[model samples]
Target chain A: MFPRPLPEEKPLQRGLYVGFVALILILWLLPLFAVMLTASKTADEIMAGQYWTWPKHFNLIENFQAVFAQTNMWGYFINSLIITLPSVLLVLVFSTLTGYVLARYNFKGNALVFALFVGGNFLPAQIMMIPVRDLMVSVGLYDTYLALIIFHVAFQTGFATLFMRNFIAALPDELFQAARAEGASPWQTLRHVVIPLMRPALAALAILTFTFVWNDYFWAIVLTQSDAVKPVTAGLNNLRGEWTSAWNIVAAATLFVAVPPVTMFFLMQKHFIAGLTMGAVKG
Target chain B: MSELWKRHRNWLAPLLFIAPGALLFGTIIIASSFESVWISFFDWDGVGPKTWAGLANYRELFADPQFYVSLKNNVIWLVMFMAAPPLGLALALLVNQQVAGMRFLKSLFFIPLVLATVTVGVVFGWVYDPNYGLLALIFNLFGATAPALLADEHAVTFAVVVAALWPQIAFCMVLFLAGLNNLSPDIIGAGRVDGARGWNMLWHVVLPQLRQVGFIALAVTVVGALRSFDMIAVMTSGGPFGSSEVLAYQMYEQSIFSYRFGYGAAIATVLFAIMIVFITWYLRMMVRLEKETR
Candidate 1:
C-alpha cells in the first residue's frame, strides 16, 4: 500500500518490476551459485575453464569427502561444536538471569549497569584484543577451547542481556505480582513462571548465539594457535592457505563450513530474523 | 539463616542473579578495554617483561605509512559501504509486495548473510579470481580481460568492500523490510487520498517513517565497516604489500604476526577512540528508549 501494490500497478510496470526483482536476485545469489557449482565439480573440470557450466563430472560427494579426510576440517568442525554449545548455554544462563533481574528489579545503578552492557556490546573488539589475549595467557587459557568459549560467553552476554532484558520487560507485570502473591520466592517465580514463558526468547538467543560463535574468526585466530583447538572459521582460513589453487576443494570446504549456520538459519528463520532485527525495528 | 534470607532476599536475589554476567562482562570487556589503553603505553611482547614506552608507539604510529594506508582504506570502506542502506531500502521495497514466490526469492537473497564472513570472502575471492573467475568469464564474453582485483594495490580494498557489501546490503534490506511491515496503514491511506504516489509517496511518506530503521542501518553499517578484518584477512591478507589493511586487520597483524603487543594496543586504542563516538550516541538512544518504556 505504501508504494502502491502491484495489483494496482499498470501491467507494463508490474512486469518490469518483476523482471527487475528477478534480475537483482540472480545477481545477489550469483557468487553463492558459483561456489555451489564449483563445489560439485572436479579439479580437472574447474581447470577446464567451464566454471559456470554444468560440471562435466558431478564430484560433490568426492569433493566434500576429500575436504574432510585430507584436512583438519572434521577436527575444526568438532572444535566449533565444542566451542559453540557450551558458549551458548553459558551465555543463556548468565543473560537470562541478568535480564530477569534487570527487568524486574528497581535498584541503584540499574540504568548505569544496563548502559555499560549496551555500550560494551558496541565497542570494537579490537579494543579488547590485546588485553584479553594477555589475560588469557596469564590465566593459561590461550590456545584452549575454554579461552574461546569464555570470551564469547562474556562478550555475547552484553548483547544477550540487552535483548533478554527488553524482552522480559515487555511481559506483563501482573504475572510477576500474581506469582509473588502466591508466596513464591523470586528465584522460584523465575524458574517456574518466567522460564517457561521465555522459551521463544531463549530459542532466538540460542540460535543467534550459536551462529555467532560458530562463525567467529577474530577470537578464533587470536585465542587459538593450532588445529587442535581452532574452530572452522580459522581452520578454513588455514585451509585456504594450504589449498590455494585447489579451487574445487576450497569451494567444497567453504560450503561444508557454511552448512551448520545456513541450516540453522533456514530452520529457525523466524527467530533468526526476530533476534537480529530486535533493536532495529523498535529503537 | 532463614531470618537472614527472608530479610535480605529483596535486594539479594537481584544481585545474585546479576553477579555472573556482571562479573564476566566487567573482567573481559570493561576491565580489558581499560587495560588495553594502559598497555598502549608500554612495550611488551606476549612473553616478555613490560618496558615503559610512553607515546613512542603513538608517535611511531603517526609516522607509519602503513597506518595511513590502513586509515585511507577504512575511509574507502566507510564511503563505499554507504551504498548498502539505500540499496537495501530499494530491495526491501521491491520484494515487500504481495507477489507470489517473493518469500523464496527473499530467502535466496538471505543466503550470503547466513554464510560466514570467511566463507563469503572465500567465495567472492573465487568469483574475482583473474584466471578462471566469474568476473574473468564475463570479461571474456565481452572480449576483454578481468583485472586481478585482489592483486592490485589500487583495487583490492574496493574489491573486498564490494564483497562485504553483498551481505551488508542483505542485512539492511531485512531491517528495512521489518520497518516496512510496521508502517502505519492509516498514513499511507491518507497519503493516497491526498494524491501522493510513486516517488513522492516513497520519498515523503514512507521514507520519513523509516527514519529509525535507516538510522540503525547506517550505524550498523559504520560499525561493520570499521570491524572489517576477517574479509581482508581471508581474501588478501592485507596483501599487495598491506594495501587493503584496515585498522582492525592491521591491529591483528601487528599483535599476532608481528609480535608488537604495544603497537597493536595502540592501534586498538585508536580504533576504540573512533568507536566510542558512535557508541556514545547508540547508548544514549538505547537508554532513552529504555526510560520511555519504563
Candidate 2:
C-alpha cells in the first residue's frame, strides 16, 4: 500500500512485451510480405527488383495463372493431399493402437521396443536416405506417391508412437484392467475403450501428423521424382528452374501453395501445438 | 506349464498387431537406416558394383574441415535450440487470452510452421537478398546498408539459423499455448488467492506445471534443429564457403554430392550417437518423473 501502482505498469510492460512480441512477429511476417508483394508485381517491376516496395500495378490473377501454367501448382497440391492424408491417418490409427498396446501391456520387449522407437525418432534422415531411396527403387515403388507415403508413415511412427504411447500410458491403468475384465476383445477394447478415451490424443495426432507430412520436404525430394509424383514442397523448387528471375511468379507460387497447411494451422492451432510439444519436456 | 504356453501361443493375434507397423517400421526405417552404413563402405557410384573402403571415408572426414564446421554448427544449434522453451512460454502468455482475433493472431504466428522447408528456404533466401530484397530495401529506407545474409561468411550461418528460427519459434509457441491451456486453473486460482502474483504465479505455479510441456517442446525443437535438412538444401545449399553447414547437410554433401558414402555414413553415425545421448537422457528424466508421480 505504500507504493501506488504505476498507472502505466500494466499497459507499459505488457505493452512493451506485446511490442517485443509484435516486432518479432513482424520479423516473422516480413518474408511473407515480400512474397506477397513480389507475387503481385509485374514482370517488368520484378526485373527492376523493387521487391519490398508497393506494387506499381497489382497482377495477382495473371501471375498466379502463370505460376499454375508453369508448375502445375495445383497438381502438386493434390499430390500433397494424396500423400499427406493417408500418411496422417495411418499415423493416427497405428500410433494410437501401438501406443495403447505399449501403455497397457507390460509385455516383454516393452522397454526395448520403446527404446527402439526413441532411437528411431532420433536417427538422421540422411543416413537412411541412400538405402531408403535404393529400397524404393528396388521395390519398384520409386517415383511413386506410395514411396513418399510409406516412408513418411513409417518414420513418423517413431515420433508419433512416442507421443501416443506416453499420452495413453498417462491414462489410468484401471480403465484397461476394467476393459479386460469386461471380456472386451483386444480389438474391441482398443476401439471402444482406448480409442474413445483418446479423442483428444487422436485429434492431436491427426493435426500434428498432417502438418508434418504436409510440410515434409527431405523425403519428398529423396523418394519421389518428376513433377508427376512431386508434392508442392518439391514443386516450389522446380518453379525456380529458368524463370528464377521472375520473383513475382516465385512469390505467387509460394503463396498459392502455402495456403493449405497455413489454413489448417490457423484453424486448429491449439490442437496442433498440443500434439507437437506433448513429449518435449518429458520425453 | 505346457497348457499355459499353448494357451498363450495365439501367434496370429500378436502377428496381426505387429504386422503392418512393424513390417514397414523394420524394413524401411530400422533396416534401411543401417543399410547406408553398409553401402557407405563401398566406392559404388550408386550404379556399379560396390567396392568396399573400410576406413578410407572416415579418414577423409576426419581431415575435412567442412565436417568440423558442420559439427560445430550442430553444437551451436543444440545449445541455442533450448531457447524455444522459455521463449515459447513467454509467447504463449503474451497471446493466450480472450481478446478479439486472438485466434487469427495465433494462426498468423503459426504460418511459418505450416509452410514447407522449400518455401522457408526460398523465402528467406530472397528476404536476405543483398540487392533489392525486402530486408535490403528496408535498410535503404533507413538510409543505411545491409549485409548479404546468404553470401557473407560471418552472417550466412547466422542468417540461415534465424530463418530456421522463424518456424521453430512458431513451433515453440504451439507447445506453450497447449501447456498454458491445459494448466490447472484451480491451482492457479488458489495461488492467486494466496497472493501469488505476477512472477511468483508464473514461477511457483505455472512453470512447474509447464515443465512436462517444456520437455516436449525442447525435445521436438532439439530434434528440429538437429534434423534440419530441407531448409539448408533449399536456402543456401551450404553456401558462403560452407559456413552454414550442419551435420545433416554434411552427411548429404558427403554421401550424395562428393560420393563419399562411407564418410557420410560415419558422419551420420556421429549425429545418431549425439541424438541417442539426448534421447536416453530425456527418457531417463521422463521415466524418473513418472516414477516419482506414481
TM-score of each: 0.96, 0.89
Best by DockQ: 1
* TM-score, cand. 1: 0.96
Model 2 chain B poorest ten-residue lDDT run: B5-14
- Give per-residue lDDT, candidate 2, residue A68: 74
- The per-candidate count of clashes, in order, stands at 0, 7
Candidate 2 displacement at residue A232 in angstroms: 1.1
Give the worst 10-residue stretch by lDDT in candidate 2 chain A. A1-10
Error of 2 at B79 (Å): 3.2
Clashing pairs in 2: A279-B216, A280-B215, A280-B216, A280-B217, A281-B214, A281-B215, A281-B216
Model 1 CAPRI quality: medium
lDDT of 1 at A157: 100
Q: Looking at model 2, give its docking quality level.
A: acceptable
Cα lDDT tens digits, model 2, A131-231, are 88777888899899999998999988988888888898888878878986886667777778777778888887888788778888888877787888899
Q: Candidate 1's residue-wise lDDT over A256-277, tens digit each?
A: 9999998999899889888888
